[model samples]
Target chain A: MARASVTRLTGRPLLSRRQDGLALRRAMPDRLLPALVAAMTFLAALALAGAVGASLLAQRWNNGAAAIMTIQVPDADAPAATGAGKRGDAVLAVLSHDPAFAAAIPVDRARLAALLAPWLGGAGGSGTGAPALSLPGVIQARLRPGVDPPADLAARLESAAPGTLAERNQPWTARLVALTRSLQACAALALLVVTGVAVAVVAAATRAGLAARRHSIEIVHGLGAGDGYIAGRFARRTTVLALSGGIIGTILSVPLLLLLCRLGAPFASGAALPPTLPDGDLAAYLSDALARVPLPLWIALPLLPPVSASIGWLTAQFTVRAWLRRLP
Target chain B: MIRLDEIALRYPGRDPNRGAVLQRISADIPSGGFRWVLGASGAGKSSLLRLLSLSLKPTSGQLEVLGVSVNRARRAALARLRRRTGTVFQDLRLLGELSVFDNVALRLRLDGLPEDRIELEVTEMLRFVGLGRKLDVRPHSLSGGEQQRVAVARAVVHRPPLLLADEPTGALDEKQAIRLISLFEELNQMGSTVLVATHNEALVRRFGHPALVLERGRLVSHG
Candidate 1:
């Protein structure tokens, strides 16, 4: 009879028959493989999320750093003819004329005092009822893109307002950028290591599976099944296991990633809270920290499952083929 | 059809002085020919079948099956050649987890036959072997005789041109053995070249087929 006739006669699809005929996998149960894969995928997703979050945070820091320029007007203590405030006004006026400066605003004495309030003992004045400390007049400037010849601008500003110092914010910005880059590199390296571990875990599991099913494999081989056929079975099985595990791991990691961001939120947004607290209250400390990451970083989290599934599939295929070659 | 010339098979790590399993062995099996291979225990009958099945390569010498040189053929070609030959192992080798029908249908499936055709042929073959009612039963659930029949049905279900049975009747009673041998005879009558290896010399004599006898892994007589 023609092969198609059997399907028609049985009223079953070819795929069902093919699956039913695969007695080897049924003969061997894989209880640990899926769990291992899931755990690996979970760790991998977390690492990937960390890398993406670092990248977004770094970009934000770079943008903020690039636009800022600070000018310090040292207090003269005389408070009379051409004081620090006049010098600050002169610097702002000079910056306003240059196309390179987007905006130049003076920092008021009150705002400066508030910034130094903690160090100066209190918000109103010194704690011992002494007069409030005199602070320098500062100018905050925003520079336009591609107009960052800070040295020339600083020299011009210094000449325009004597006793004033023009400081380009680029040096500190460069250092912060370098630090973020290093963090990103570390996250990426962690992700690579996790992926390698995942592959190794899957490979080891596949080898164990092969050893367990050696008898059935020999029967199939003796029955004329090719190595490709055997390897394809293993690949499909491992891929399914890995895909399920990856989905589970990815799902489980979302809340963890969110909690991480929340914990870091206080630092990222520069929100103020008490620096000193009762020791050993970890939960309370974490509760005070909250952070929000960009939506794109969260969106990238879903791709981990498929990537992990593909890795599992390829690892199984390579393992099976290599193992079979060792046999007669 | 099968051909062997000066084929020698030795297990790896064995003493060299012990000699090969089948040293300088040579034989020819013609198309549609039925032959019985007689030998004592450890006479290398299974090893000879392994060579014919393309599961093992001769250490040195020439072998061919279905007109393809085993040593010279590519791996894919050898697989194709194997597909054209059916073997009933001494151990039966029935997958314990699969149903009897699935065990028989595996051969046809490996040939890429459609589901409907596999079901039809497997059912018909099972019925022919008196196993029509045990289609969904696993091999381990069946009696030893029933499992042997399942193995036989599996081997011949694909209608291969050559069929090899290694001690297929070892687990059968006198009546069951006779029935199984008749099944082999019926298949041979249908133009399949059949080879049966057995220790039952009386049955061999009564069936009156051409016989090849082996002693200590050497072909002693062939007629």
Candidate 2:
């Protein structure tokens, strides 16, 4: 008389017996649950990926920004460039002598010219028939970890080499950190909302399914089937459906994710670009402005299906048990 | 065995006040007793059977079935009580998608009986009810009499101590009805307490079993 023994005798699995006992008919059209779950999971995966990427990008930018300083020497008094060169070399020599500074390198004219080429038009220098622009001499410094440059270091450099300014550029780095944090928060919020909506959708469908099978359920209950027995059947069915939909949704999202990655690849790979650029190099400038996400973050995408399945299973169990309490 | 003490069943109505379906009704059916509940249509015969089967709670009375005081039984206890009894619904509530064999085997399955025993018992019961050939057929595909037989087989396949049938022969022809009554008699002789509720007084009179009569939701006679 045990259900297990009966299943063994009938050669039907437990799920088949439960489903068959409920009289599988088109009485309940539940095609929507899986589809909805799949769609939600797809959206959730994308949001999760975005949040992870933003977090990693923020950390990278914070570390990179914290360890660097820039020194700009203007050519206001020198003959078009000689005075700027001497002041830049003087600043580099000063930085090199400090034990706290790991490296101090001067930016060559060709590299500086190339950096200004986007705005001035053509290649570095005046060779590309672009406007002749007076650019400053720049020195880049790398500091040892935990080393704070002396607060009076910039004043000392300015007094020794006139018309030169020193900057740690912490404010810009702070702004970038804040922006990435906001983006990560938004992505997390979106993920939570999508998962909640998916669970709600499954719960609603389970109720409808129970309503359609109410008569059969009553018959089974009258015949001595326990509430746990009935609820297990529903939970199993919904779990399978939700898991399938989640996998499909996750699989479908891969192409979209790849396309997004491709679109942002150029920006992620390049150095920071100026705010304003010539009309022709806008794509390149945009590419340089964005950072490519690291590979490890993709691992989280595969976990969505199982998470969705667990949610579906719990929702169905709760819905069925609550509904059964109202029965005789 | 079944016992009722001033059992009153009142279904909630759209209006705030409605009379009980069965008011101040009391009766006792001893073990192995074959009883006929005779009444006109809507005389609460089905309602009484539902109470005996533990499908409904008495509004203001006590009920005992198979030695268990079911009126105050918890859900799990009621389920155990239900398992000891079998009911043949008036509408023949066989799962339409299941084969006749599966329908009859369901009761034994619920009891967690072994597969070989379920198969042997279900097959024998179907054969006794003259439905052996239709074992693989769905209930919807069977004739009315065949469907009734399927319901009867399903009810008694597990050999429960109490068997309650509500208008089981309503859909049968005279010859088929007699055959069904004989089958019930055979089961009664095997020591199950049988209660058949029907509006067909002639059939009840012909069998001449100990009987109860209900009139307008009240027990009018027990003889």
Report chain B TM per candidate. 0.95, 0.95
User: Highest lDDT among the candidates is held by which one?
Assistant: 2
lDDT of 2 by residue, A208-257 (tens): 88988888888888888878878887888888889988998999987677
Calculate DockQ per candidate and list them.
Answer: 0.43, 0.33
The true-structure Cα RMSD of candidate 1 reads 4.8
Q: What docking tier does model 1 reach?
A: acceptable
lDDT by residue for model 1 over A3-118, one digit each (tens)?
56656655555555454344535533455666776787778767776676666566656666567788886652333234544655667777888888888888776676667777
Per-residue lDDT for A223 in model 1? 83
The weakest ten consecutive residues by lDDT in model 1 chain A span A76-85
Candidate 1 regions exceeding 4 Å error are A1-31, A75-85, A122-132, A265-291, B72-74, B173-182, B185-191, B206-209, B221-223
Best by TM-score: 1
TM-score for each prediction? 0.86, 0.81
Error of 2 at B47 (Å): 0.7
